[model samples]
Target chain A: MHEYSVVRSLLRQVQEIARSNGGGAIETIRLAIGEFSGVECTLVELAFRDLAPEKIGRQAKLEIQNIPLEAKCENCQQNIIITNYQFCCPRCNSQQVRITAGDELTIIDIELREVGVNA
Target chain B: MNQTITVNRDLKADLKEQANRFRQRMSDQGTLVVNLVSSPGAGKTSLLQRTATKIGDEYRLAVLVGDLATDRDAERLKPYVPVQQLTTGGACHLEIPLVESGYERLNQSDLDILFIENVGNLVCPASHDLGEYLRVTLLSVTEGDDKPGKYPKMFRTSQAMVITKSDLLPYVPFDVSSAVEDARRIQPELDFLTTSSQTLAGVDEWCEFLVRQLRKIQK
Candidate 1:
């Protein structure tokens, strides 16, 4: 799976952010993963577990939020929660639906312990 | 002390931006980049072989073929066009960096078209954009008609779907219309074309499609 590579990118971004914020010990990484993002949450967590300990520390945890596939119909302007990967609008049966959300892997926020805070 | 940092960012945003920049650069050079993706053995190289024979004389074309290992595809298209192979070394997808390096190796800036034959996997390739002007997904007749519905992400992200191995349609259970219908459900404006590189059927139409895309970019 490509989740390992994706996690590597995620860790790189996290490391950059941590470094910019005074080189703290990363504690929690918050992420939002969409249903249609072509990523498996379990696989991502597995990859994170395998790769994060050495880079981000052993206690760092991933908090993942699963986002459902949602779209807006261009014809009738009806908001829809897509089911079974059907992209057609349910209200108007319009095929001209545009995805409003649920197609991304976003890093929402992160919690870090400031370096030398306990020192 | 514990501190929280709000860093709202899409993971792929940087990659997408890079792809867009590449697209603009290629557009300025009058190069139509076509990313061809499909399952392994879905006639990607075969179609390219036919495409090279059909339009290689009319256009300055090059190919960057991605595979886990092996330069066999590049060898297949060598007689027809300038070809480079980007071996991912086990990666399931061809990312932007790989595409850029492959393009540099091709070393032809005045190309009319650059075709990237992506690594043969429908899933991961759909997630990574290779700065292509046109993203075409190929479905061989032997792969069944229900693939569009099953692999929704791949079909949804693609602009066009090429039904390959049309010569084997009678032998296989693939219903072209049903596959098109299913794909169109996810992508209403998706274009569809059927061809067989073996029989050379619809090869001219495919070449014309590329020509039309090139003209669009030129204008």
Candidate 2:
């Protein structure tokens, strides 16, 4: 699936972050995946399991947080959590709504062992 | 010591930035890039054939068709316009790099429109931005009307939905109004067009829409 490629990209970003911070051994990689981001979390974990060994070591664990779609209605000016993938505003039933959050695959943080530190 | 680093970065940010820059460059060059996405056999090639027949004389059009193996799509469109086929080998979707390389292969300037016909998969293609000014998703009548609700991300990310094979409506159970309603719930502002590439029905409106989009960017 495309999750393999996505994980590849994620690991590359993680590798950069780890390298910039003293090139530590990655322990945990936390990700925030929105419901509408077109990514499957389980597939991402599966891909990471298969690919992470060489990139971030075998012991590295993945932690993914599911984010609900959030949008702001332009006409009603109400913040709403979208359900059933509906993009309309709930309060005023206005179709003029803009997505404010929950549509991205974001790397929130990473836990790693410091390069010179003992295990 | 175990150290926690706060990165808070989107994985696709760099790729998206590159795509944005590419889109800006295309806009500056007066080329309207349209990314056509759909499931396999959803009439993307058929629609392109009709579009070329309808508007080829008026606009300079070229196409970059992505598929897993064959250059068949490119071959099909060559009679009407300049075309390049991107064979992904095993990749399910087209990325920015492939698109850029395809454009380079085309090597044509003074183009009015450049259509990137993405690999035929609804799920994966929606996640990748390929530097297009417009993203149009196609759904044929045979795919059923519930597709939009099931594939929310694909419908949500698209700017327009083209219901292809409209001539098959009588025999199929697909309802056009219900399909549009389902998609609109997810997209809210998505433009809708129905076309039967076989009979060339609604192809004129599709070309007109492209013309309007071109004018908008040119201004």
How do all models score by TM-score? 0.98, 0.96
* Model 2, span B1-219: residue lDDT tens: 699999899899988998999999999999999999999999999999999988999899999999999899999999988999999999999999889998998998688999999999988898899999999999999999989998888888899999999999999999999999999988888999999998888999999999999998888
Each candidate's chain B TM-score?
0.98, 0.97
Q: Write the per-residue lDDT of candidate 2 for residues A1-119, one digit (tens) a residue.
A: 68998899999999989999989898999999997788889999899999999988887999999998899999979999999888888799998888888888999999989788766
DockQ scores of all models, one per candidate: 0.86, 0.80
What residue runs in model 1 are displaced by over 4 Å at the alpha carbon?
Answer: none
Candidate 1 residue-wise lDDT, B133-203, digit = tens: 99999999999999998889999999999999999998988899999999998888899999999999989
TM-score (C-alpha) between model 2 and the true structure: 0.96
User: lDDT tens string, model 1, A1-119?
Assistant: 79999999999999999999998899999999999998999999999999999988897999999999999989999999999988888788888888888998999999999788752
Scored by TM-score, the top model is 1
lDDT of 1 at A119: 28
Evaluate model 1: give its lDDT. Answer: 0.94
